[model samples]
Target: MSARLVLHGVCVGLLFAALAGAPTPAKAQKIYIETDLEGASGVYKFSQTREKDTPPNIEACEFLMGDIAAVVRGLRAGGAKEIIVSDGHGSQAFLPRLMEPGAKYVTGKPRPSSGLDETCDAIVMVGCHAMMGTPDGVLCHTQSSKSENRYWYNGVETGEIGQSAIVASYYGVPPILVTGDEATCRETKKFFGEHCVTVAVKRGLAREAAELYPFEETRKALFEGAKRAMAELPNCKPYQVKLPIQAKKEWYELDAKGVKGKLMTREGEILDLRDLYKF
Candidate 1:
């Protein structure tokens, strides 16, 4: 079997072993959950207003909080002791009072050092989309709202999921689960390997269209996915990239030197960065 298949098999085996053994470890597992509002179960257009130009919708905000609550419930059932849910989407204030009361909610735009990957045992990414330039990915972009469109790590094009995984790996935190659209899950696994459990709540039919599971069904899937992820934690390996990392930015305009690092790839991607900080 290929190396990837072997790794996947090992993860599965560990899940079965955990289920068959004595009760799970009594020690509490620290699970850090990061969520974006754009990829929630029924989200299509990210805007809040029904019209073209407005803020996010109130209903969408509720849906975002509810989905996060569902995941929190699942994490508790899966034996996660302490859960830290970070509002990782725009403004970082999408979910309000609906997250699990026990979960420590981190809202607002955090500093570069206060990102998703800190002193956490496992990381969970929710309501995320594919990277920039992915065909039909809903509201896809790397970090900034404009300018740099595509981001590359070690010459490979990656999205928010990739960057987050790299950060989690840097702190030796394994990404245990992710939930989003189908394309997001596939792309995340492509970059981080299949050790993480993913729930595809929607499939993007177009940039503004998608086939989504009912909100209730989406919640159920997220819960189950979290359980499986925790059960298989032992077999999950950290998504590791060698140090002395390089990053490349494909800007629509402007030269590459404006950012950090020298141009390594002929495609105008930058190289030799001083660690990836911030979302």
Candidate 2:
């Protein structure tokens, strides 16, 4: 073979090697999902979420898992590299068998954190209900339904959704999507702004009543919403709750019979956002 021809073949091989090591145009994102139960499709009554291992609760959890699966599928399609889903429900609602593939599920109690970190590119809240005292919030109650917990930070009344967002903000992670009832969607818009994608599965008529949407429709919305949320990652801003938060808390005092009684209040300052849910 001619020396010039041999040199041409070596040049081609070197070019291929350089092309193989080149970086792609887009980087896949690491997403974290925080999920609850009250806002899941078909869950409107307390009977469905207030207990553990009951038939009603089990069914509600299944509905939540289905909703999560839809979102996970959408995220995967949108080029998510890592996905972490945490059971944000009070009673820990996660059916391992129903969990979608290609994601890590976080369940059980005494979790160190909300399963979020600086590495996460975005956060998504699925099955979120409206804050406490929302007249149209289906099964709404902030921290505890029985105690009717309520919280205010810097004179702004907030709920579980706000609390979760504040913590995520601490890690510089923006909330890209939120899914729940109409009231919950409204709340998300009020807090996180229009850039955040919100999917409403139901319209709440009262604390325990709602116009539930069909699973097929809601799941489709969730899947599409998740994809939109990924696209919105660049537009969404990390929620900020001013630190040294002046906090106010209110809840019903327990009576001698273990029933909620008179309302009690407390006021204090929170030094860190992670402690926002502490008391």
What are the candidates' C-alpha RMSDs? 9.5, 6.1
lDDT of 2 by residue, 95-200 (tens): 9999899899999998766679889998999999999999999999898888888999999999888899999998999999999999999999999999999999
Q: How many backbone clashes does candidate 1 have?
A: 4
Q: Identify the candidate with maximal TM-score.
A: 2
lDDT of 1 by residue, 126-224 (tens): 888887767777666676434446776666777888777777776778888888899888887787677788998889877667887898899999888
- Tell me how far the alpha carbon of residue 21 in candidate 1 is from the true structure, in angstroms, after superposition: 6.2
Clashes of each: 4, 0
Query: Candidate 1 has which clashing residue pairs, if any?
Result: 48-55, 48-56, 48-57, 248-270
Please tell me which predicted candidate would have the highest lDDT against the true structure: 2
Provide TM-scores for the models: 0.79, 0.90
